[model samples]
Target: MHRTAPRLARILACAAVPVMLVASGCSSDSDGKPKAEKSQKSEKTDKAGSSGGAALATPESEKKPAVAPVKFTKLPEACRSLKPKTIEKLVPSTKAKAGTPGRSTDLLTRGSCSWNGLDDNGVKGSQYRWLDVSFLRFESDAALGTSGKQRAQEAYTKEVAKNRATTGAKNVKAAPSAGVGEEATALSYQLRKTGEDFSYVTIVTRTDNILITLTYNGTGYAGAKPPAVADLLKDAVPAVKETVTSVTAANK
Candidate 1:
């Protein structure tokens, strides 16, 4: 009986050892759950912040331009650009000597002015004259692969082509002008308009981004003669230069 009792007690002690081990493992799992969950949440937050920071690192809207900024911003007043001597010689009998300004929404981009007059000689001859000037400013555009000067050059060629394409024009001639701005072209032709033969002198010039255009035209009234092309071109050079100078003056 004594031997049986000792063996049973030993069996009971071994059974209690397994139960205590199971309890200890359950307590470890319970203590680790909150820490594991907290670690997972921290990892997720870190990943989300990393992704958001990457998106803000680079901005697509900041594009660099290929060229420098243009020098001239505003253009000179077209009509007022011409010198007084030029206006006087071009339109001697101008009714409004102050000159009339052309229409434009933005003077910085473009502007123009003109004058016209008639010197009436009863029973002899009458002379009629007209003069006008125009100015245009160009800006650099990197997208188009053109600087301010290049854009102005294209416009210069276009303006010359436009003058050459004049319909019903007679004796149309285009020649490069010297000693005026960076480059210039003189277009002279004879066009009959309003029952009168008129001589046209157009000068398209460019200095930097600014384009200058000077036009001088005249007709004879009551048995008069047309103005000579040579004389008109000689007088037109300085007038165009004066207009160009006005641009530099404004910039200064």
Candidate 2:
């Protein structure tokens, strides 16, 4: 009977081992489940954070607005921007009847023409005159965020400033010129060169996206009287007006 009691007690101990193992396994599973859930939650949070950041990114519609299109696409011919009679009056006895075309790599955006003449009066000094006209066309740039007219205006302002600061220029004067273009400024000055005083006139005009610069200068050689500022302006104003008209005609 004592041997039976010992065997029964061994059987109970073996059964208790299985029960303890089951309890330990269940506890492990419970702890592992919570850890796994936490890991899954962390992964979901990371994914959600990434998705939210992408949603908050800038869109195309909110970018800078594009600039407006230019009014003039091309420039007028510099040599043909004025009438022959006008040219004759401005520069008498011109060396080149057709005017000399200024060198330019791109004629569509930029061009210039110049004329110079010396009218000789046998015993009296000769009258020397030089005329130059240039055209610059600007285009709207979306990347630069600038409109063609705005760019032209900036250039126009700079041109006026430059003319006002001409080297060796004296008695410089600038005034608003009416009946010329969208905006016009007449700059006149005196400069001495080649042992003679010369009168100069620069008519800077802006029409839409185009800028027109006209410069006229004259001097008397061998004791002839130099041209008067009033006379120079009278000729420059009409010549510049004609050039402006040519711009409209060319675009048409």
lDDT of candidates 1 onward, in order? 0.86, 0.93
RMSD of each: 5.9, 4.1
Candidate 2 backbone collisions, by pair: none
Instruction: Please identify model 2 stretches exceeding 4 Å from their true place.
Output: 1-33, 41-45, 59-62
Please name the candidate that would achieve the greatest lDDT relative to the true structure.
2
lDDT of 1 by residue, 148-191 (tens): 88899899989999999999999999999988889999999999
In order of listing, the candidates' clash counts read: 0, 0
Candidate 1 similarity to native, TM-score = 0.75
Clashes of 2: 0
**Largest TM-score belongs to which candidate?**
2
